[model samples]
Target: MNMMSYAIVSVKNNSDKLNALLMGMKGVVGCDLFAVSYDDIYTVVSNVKGANLIADKINALTFAGVIDTLAQQFTLLPVRFGSLMGSADAIVKMLERNRHEILQNLLKVENKYEFGLKVFCDSGKLMEELRLKSGAGEKMHLKPSPEIKNSVYRDYLDKKLAEHRLEESMLAYVDAVITEIAGRLEHLGAVNNFKKMVSEALIIDAVFLLERDKKAELIQVVKDLQRQNAGLRFILTGPWPPYNFVDLDIK
Candidate 1:
């Protein structure tokens, strides 16, 4: 029998507690869940026939659901969705090999919540605004004599220049936003990772791991940022399972 790993929990003298928790929950494909422990660390996993398991979204969500329920009662390093081993012994051996790293990750995420913030915009409107600004710049720089407006090459160059300037402006704007968010989260002592310009509709995708008790304050701070950043919509989600903060390698 194979085992699908859900999370690496800091069981730390609490295996019985984790066991009872798993009894009331389900794992991928609604399989009964169990734990493989080594000292203070536990990997929550479920029995699955190697041939029967389908690594699809449904199973992934089922795996995540189990992790979610486990997270409510423990601080865990959420294993990647499709992680599987040939047996419970394999998981234990893997844990024994990577024990130090896993324990360190668990300690890092203890009592911390992971929050996601996405910054989105309507690209068309933003482009028009940039065009108007660039047009204003062109007029100020042109000679006093009225220049011909219809040179095809010049028009193309001007458009390209405007696009370049617009991108630079957007990048600068994103930098300022990142600075602002960092300043706001400084007090919370959050560890964050950010990706800018993920897509036109999704300009910024960021996640922060911070003290769990500050959830309300984090929301308020983001609300404040939303009000300050005009034309950009911010969506904040989670207290999640330290999904983005777990930094570990199973050696």
Candidate 2:
């Protein structure tokens, strides 16, 4: 039978404990589960036949839920969906090949948890506000007046200038938000990675790796931020295994 593999959960060199954890747990679509190990790291896997390999939203969510459940019990590196190996022996050899790097990554995230923060805003509304704010500033010098014969050139320049100013304003607004978040997290001593303008509506896509005990504090921080910025929506997902923080790419 084909196998559907998930990730390598850390066991601290105890295979029996890892096996026991996998015993009753279900994987994507309630498949039968088993494990493949290399020293302290174990990849929990399940059987997948012909029709099961096709990607489905429910299957993906179920797989993620499985990983989340396992993460509550042990340190693990969540493998990307559809990651598979031939057999238990193949997984063991793969782990053995990438042992040092895997351990290093495991140690990096040992007792920490990961949180994803996605900040959304009404782009059209926000941009309109930004344009009004920018317009209030000093106007740029116009070399050629719009009333002149080459008014088309002037119009083009004006449009381009407005576009540039809008981009700058958006970036500035994003920076201010990031700065506020950083300041709050600094007080809590959290480590974070942030990306701005991931999508038009999603202005900030960020992840934080923090002590598991500080989950409540982090949630409060996000709530406070949302309260302070009524125009933006903060959607926080996780307490996850450090999927975003893992720094290794095993060959």
Candidate 3:
């Protein structure tokens, strides 16, 4: 039978403890919990037939919940969903092959947690705000010369130019916001990954990895950022298992 696997957890010197933990917990969708080990690292997995795999929500929030439970008790590298091996022995061999990388990753995130932040805004409203702000500057001079003629072609070109300028201004505004956020996070000394303009609504999508103790402070910071930017919405989720911060890929 095939299996639906989630992660390779680092048991370190507590392999027996990990085994005990797995013995009590159930896998997703009624699968049996089992482990495949290589010295210190253990892949906590469950058997699943290929047809049954469809029942598992590949990146669903439930998967994160399971990973979260495990992370609370051990250091782990979260595997992307659909990471399946034929059998427990195959998983063990994979862990053995990637032992060094796994250990390094475990050390890196041993006591840390990950948080996801998404900033969203009404793009049209924001664009209007930007236009109002930009309008304070002197207007560009377009004398009624041949180049400034209001022909159909000229009108189309001008519309496109205005759109291009608005886009540029929007990007610059988003960058400024990101810079401000990063500066604030700097005080906490956290590691962050940020992506700008992920969608029309999501202006800033960022993830931060920091000491588990910093959760409250991070929440306050995000609250403050939201207050400072009334036009945007900030959604913060986690204290996750460093899923986004993992740097190792199994060989």
Rank the models by TM-score, top first. Answer: 1, 3, 2
Q: Residue 226 of model 2: what lDDT? A: 98
Clashes of 3: 0
Q: Estimate candidate 1's RMSD in Å.
A: 2.6
Query: In model 2, what are the clashing residue pairs, if there are any?
Result: none
lDDT, candidates in the order shown? 0.85, 0.85, 0.82
Which residue pairs in candidate 1 have backbone atoms (N, alpha carbon, C) closer than 3 angstroms, thus clashing?
none
**The best candidate in terms of lDDT:** 2
Residue-level lDDT of model 2, residues 10-47, one tens digit each, is 78767777678778788877787888766667888998
Best by TM-score: 1
Off by over 4 Å in 3: 55-62, 136-138, 141-150
Candidate 1 lDDT tens digits, 166-196 = 8887777778888889999999899989999
TM-score of 2: 0.90
Stretches off by above 4 angstroms in model 2 are: 140-149
| Native-to-model Cα distance after best TM-score fit, residue 163 in candidate 3, in Å | 1.5
Ranking by lDDT: 2, 1, 3
